[model samples]
Target: MTARRSMIRRAAAVAAAATAAVVLAACGGGNDSSAGHEGHGKSPSPSASAPASASASAKQGEHNAADVSFAKGMIPHHRQAVEMAELAETRAGSAEVKKLAAEIKKAQGPEIKTLSGWLTSWGEAVPTEEESGEHAGHSMSGMMTPEEMDKLQKSSGKAFDTAFLQMMVKHHEGAIEMAKTEQSNGAYRPARDMARAIITSQSAEIERMNKLFGKS
Candidate 1:
């Protein structure tokens, strides 16, 4: 009887050990599955987020007629400024004037391209100098007339420097006016942002020029 009871106890111990091992395996498998599901639920995939960001950027590019006008008008305006800046290389006497002209060219040259791109994207016609001639009588503010441009091209040394500064000061003021209109009326973010930058930077340049030329 003593031996039989000992054998029964040993069998019961073996059965309990097997049952515990089975329970532990099942619990570990369930925990792993839960962790996988939690990870999947926590964050979006990179591929999914990229398209959303792109769509938002596209929406920002969408523009209105005011935005279109701002771009169309600014293109030629910038082009003419670049033209004036080019003359500074040969005509300006002051190092400061030459530097300012170069800065204007650098800033506006790419801006002309950007404005043209915006017009094209909006399905509007980009204006050329010839095409822009229809508005010759009512030229955009601060534009140099043919006579004024001729005068600038004719002058050199101090005469060129003085004329360039005066013309550019007027030119920058016109840009600020246009920028204000864009700020108040335009819908495209990039165009409006450019307008604001033009206002700020050109305003500072205007002040610098005034101080340089002894003009209030």
Candidate 2:
């Protein structure tokens, strides 16, 4: 019962994260459909508008320059982790597995927002890296491949629990790698701190997951 509860909680958090991110991104982070125009008036002459546009563009460009590297790199990075968490929520039967998923979702969701906030402040598009390819079965730390996700999607009971634990272990490790990279190369201090914290917590979680899966 506890395990089920935990898994449910984690699932909720992951769903919330995905939902919130899409909402926030839609609202402001990525596309500014209104950027070039103002209320149904004749378009400002480029001669007059050029400087404003250029300035806005320049600010956005700088924001991208300053923040893009973090958002671009982190978005995909967090996405994979979220995917892994989602898998754990559905398949994991153990309280530990569910708890891990919740932790992952909680952590990454905020990080996603932090990065999104950066882009919003900078007035730039959300980095586009995560959208480039199919995420269906791509593997990371312990993230299942397509086959693996397929298996989990089909399995039930203990089978799901074991697989979830094993896969999440690997997925978390992958996340650790990305986090380390950000810690070293990410432009923003907060982003870098997020990377470091992910590494620390996930590394600890990896050990726990290993024990749960008897991989220890």
Candidate 3:
């Protein structure tokens, strides 16, 4: 009886040892799996996120000098166009001229703001009204001389309509020229897109004005 009890106790001890071994192995595997997951998670986050942020920053700041020049030049160009359009409200006789003038103001007013915003974001100077007047005398194309502006301001009715249409056609041509340059040389996407838009819209307006001249 004593021998039998000792053998039974020994068998129970062997079973417990086997069970403990399995549990320890399972614990060690779980720890290894958890550690592996943590390592994988940590490795990808910084590397993956870093490139994404850098790419975004690169895209945001992606602009060349041509883009800057486009924005700087277009701001005042648009401002002057708006100024001419405003004169048409009071001076123009033709209903068609008034409507076209309104459209020019509507289109160019927002563009002036957009160009100014782009310049501001690029840390460039926005053209002031005074600066715009100064630029009108020299570098910018299609800008009316002070005498011409004075004439437009003084004239009314059919005379004003003729002058306005003639001047606007010339102005749009100049804007189209500038826009083409931007399309060719500018690096910023938004600025390039604006250039394309300017080309399309102003070209159409020029064609319309030419037709109006034919009618006159």
Count clashing residue pairs in model 3: 0
Model 2 per-residue lDDT tens digits across residues 33-82: 55534444566576987888788775532422434665655666676667
* Residue runs of model 3 more than 4 Å from their true location after superposition: 1-57
lDDT of 1 by residue, 24-141 (tens): 9999999998999998887777987998899998887678888988888888788878888999998898888889899999999999888888888778889978744436416798
> By the TM-score metric, which is better: model 2 or model 3?
3
TM-score attained by model 3: 0.74
Per-residue lDDT of 104-141 in model 3, one digit per residue for the tens? Answer: 99999988888888888889989888877755657878
Of 1 and 2, which scores higher on TM-score?
1
Candidate 1 Cα errors over 4 Å, as ranges: 1-60, 132-137
Candidate 3, position 152, lDDT: 89
The lDDT ranking, best first, is 3, 1, 2
Q: Candidate 2: what lDDT?
A: 0.69
The Cα local distance difference test for each model comes to 0.87, 0.69, 0.88
What ranking emerges by TM-score with the best candidate at the front? 3, 1, 2
Best by lDDT: 3
Clashes of each: 0, 6, 0
Residue 4 of candidate 1: its Cα lDDT? 100
Structural similarity to truth (TM-score) of each candidate: 0.70, 0.57, 0.74
- Each prediction's RMSD over C-alphas, in Å, is 7.3, 34.9, 5.5
